[model samples]
Target: MVNKILCATRNGIGGEIVQVQANFVRALPAFVITGLANSSIQESKQRIQSALHHIGFHFPALKIAINLAPADLAKSGSHFDLPIALLIALHKKGIDTQEWFAFGELALDGTLTYNDNIYPLLLEIALRHQNAKVILPTSGQELFCHLPHLQIYYASSLQEALQILESPESTPAKTQTTLNFDTIHIGDTDYYYEREFPLDFIEVKGQEIAKRAALIAASGFHNILYEGSPGCGKSMIAKRLRYILPPMSLEEMIESVKLQALSAQKPSYTPLRPFRSPHQSASKSSILGSATQNEAKPGEIALAHQGILFFDELPHFGKEVLESLREPLENNELVVSRVHSKISYPTAFLFVGAQNPCPCGNLLSPSKECRCTPKDISSYKSRLSEPFLDRIDLFVQMQENEQDPKPSLDSATMQQMVFHAFSAQKQRGQSRLNGKLSEREVEEICILDDATQRILLQARERFNLSHRAIQKLKKLSRTIADLDNAKDIAKSHFLEALSYRYIS
Candidate 1:
């Protein structure tokens, strides 16, 4: 007798269907599984056999050959245990086995267990197999419920699964809900912190121009660099800027959840904008996701999707590591190429970098005397290539202040302003903020008056701005105008945008 059960195998983020075919022939007893099985799939034979004996079912002492169909594709993971066991059981009981899909891990006691990659499997199953009934473990049912147009069956044990299959008409139907699987099942919510900009413009006690630049960066999602001596509150203000940024939309939230899942990060629901601070000693693979023999994982930039990727002490990082960000910074996606496959992960993050003016950390300090020579300062600056610097939209010089004052706008106040600005941008019938605007969108939204155009042209000549720098300036200026509720790009906005450019 022969029986077949439908199952799935996941490769990367996608899933492929594997038909588990069991043949009980009248010959010498031997159990075999073919179809390019990996170590994990090969090991499932023992797990399934042990689970069957644990449930008081005898192993058929016949030539039992199990074959995963489509003999070319590789099958991995323990998710095939349940389906293989079910195929053997149906063959033993002489039951029909062609109407349903089954996937789950099995305990030694025959209890159904959850598999780690079930979410992607469920998504793929829902998308590919519409008419087939899906039988997954009870614990994974909540995640699978979000998927529509499928008859889902929840199984707690091998015996229970058999009972449901034997008496399908007697089993009760389950109601489907509209809940989002991404938002549920997060173990820890308290550890997830949103960006809170507690230090306001008034609290700085000085550097009003820097405060204005910060506001523009937050409003437009533009990249900003703060270069000054140590203890200038550049780091302080940058940390707080996250709190002042606008909230994420539902689509953004979904993207964030997917990225976190891909990276195996917990606390999937993140209401606040993500602020990723990678250390100077971080590796290239950590910054950009690496591809392995089995899967490709998301890197820091992808994890910071739709949020901020902050690199403090910018020049201290490896030149190669810093330059690696050029592609993702421009394309909003990271392409990891391996010998076999090239996978692209979305990484649409706002870049914010902070650094000292010199190695001594006092080149621009008002009260401290600079100990470093001009050569040292030049060497430090040259470490960051011009191409990398040009990608930065705003670069402001922070000056040390002696006084410490209360913050002008707390997180709550700044969040309100940011929300309002975001609302205004949306009112323009475009969901993208200023920083994310395409060149055509930039030309459409950021219309400069004749006087403002002349000012930008002069700045372009005076500052020796590259083509990329000019576009970045226009985008930043548009964000500033949006922040102030201004109808057009004014000269002041252009000046504010230009002031952020890093110059010795």
Candidate 2:
């Protein structure tokens, strides 16, 4: 007897359908699996046999052979355990089975264990088969409640799963009501409320110019570089910027949740934007992304999709790793090309970098004397290449004070202003925020006066700005103008935008 079951496999955040074919015949008693399975998958034979005995089910004494079809693509992970077990049961019992998708991990005691990478499987199945039944572990039941129009069977043990499979009529079908998997609303809870930003512009006591620059960076989703002495609040202000940014939309939230699900992180359907701060010692593969023998996994950038990717102590990162971000930063997606497969992962994120003026950290201090030579400072700055700096839009310098002042504006007030500005930009036919606008859209929306244009041209000549940098400046100026509710870019906006240019 031969039985086939449908299972799902994920390849670099994308999903593929796998067919598990099992055959039982009157031959020498043995178990075999084929179709380029990895070690973990090959080990499923022992797990299945042990789980069957623990569940008080008898294993078939006849020759048993299981093959995962589409034999060319390599299959990995222990997720195939449940499907393999079901096929074995069908072969042993002579039960007719062919219509469901099964995925789960089995414990030694036959209890079902939660498996990672269920979201991609669910999404792929939803796209292919509309009325397919998915048998998942009961432990992960909550994760699927948001998905609608699919039949879900929550099984706690192997015996329970066998029972559900054997008696099709007894299984209760999932509800047909449409459910939005995005936008988790929390009423009267801390999860719903944005966190209070401890560091505010007024509290800085100085550097009003830097404060204005921060506002523009936040409004436009522009990458910012803050260079100053050690005691300055460069890091402090960068951390607080998220509190004042506009909330995420339903589409952004769903995309983020999908990435989180792929990374095996908890998916929260909340409005809070993601913030990723990786250490400088992180590897290129970990930061960018790497391919396994079978599938590719998302790295830090993908995890921070639609949010902030802050690199504190920027110069401390490896030059190669930092340079790898040039493509993803420009294209909003990272393409990991392996010999066997080419996988692209979405990595649209806001880049925020901070660093000291020099190795001594006192090169730009007003009161403190500089100890590092000009050679030393140049060497330190060169660690961040011009190509990387060209991608950054806003650069500001922070100043430290002996006494921090009282708060000027709280997160709520700042959030309101950001929200209003965002609304105005959207109303102007610029659907996305300033940071994500294309060249044509930027030119369409960021119209400047003659005086502002002259100033930008002069600054472009003096700073030797690249075409990309000039466009970035225009976008930043547009964000500043939008925040002030101005119809066009004024002299003030142009000056502020120019000040952010890296001065050698």
lDDT of 2 by residue, 426-462 (tens): 6676657888778888778878889988988898788
Query: How many clashes does the backbone of model 1 have?
Result: 5
* Consecutive 10-residue window with the lowest summed lDDT within model 1: 182-191
TM-score of each: 0.84, 0.86
lDDT of each: 0.76, 0.77
Which pairs in model 2 have colliding backbones?
none
Tens digits of per-residue lDDT for model 1 on 218-325? 888888888888877777777777767766654465456556656676524456778899999999999887886567777888888778898999999999999998
- Sequence-dependent TM-score of model 2: 0.86
Q: Residue 392: error of model 1 in Å?
A: 0.7
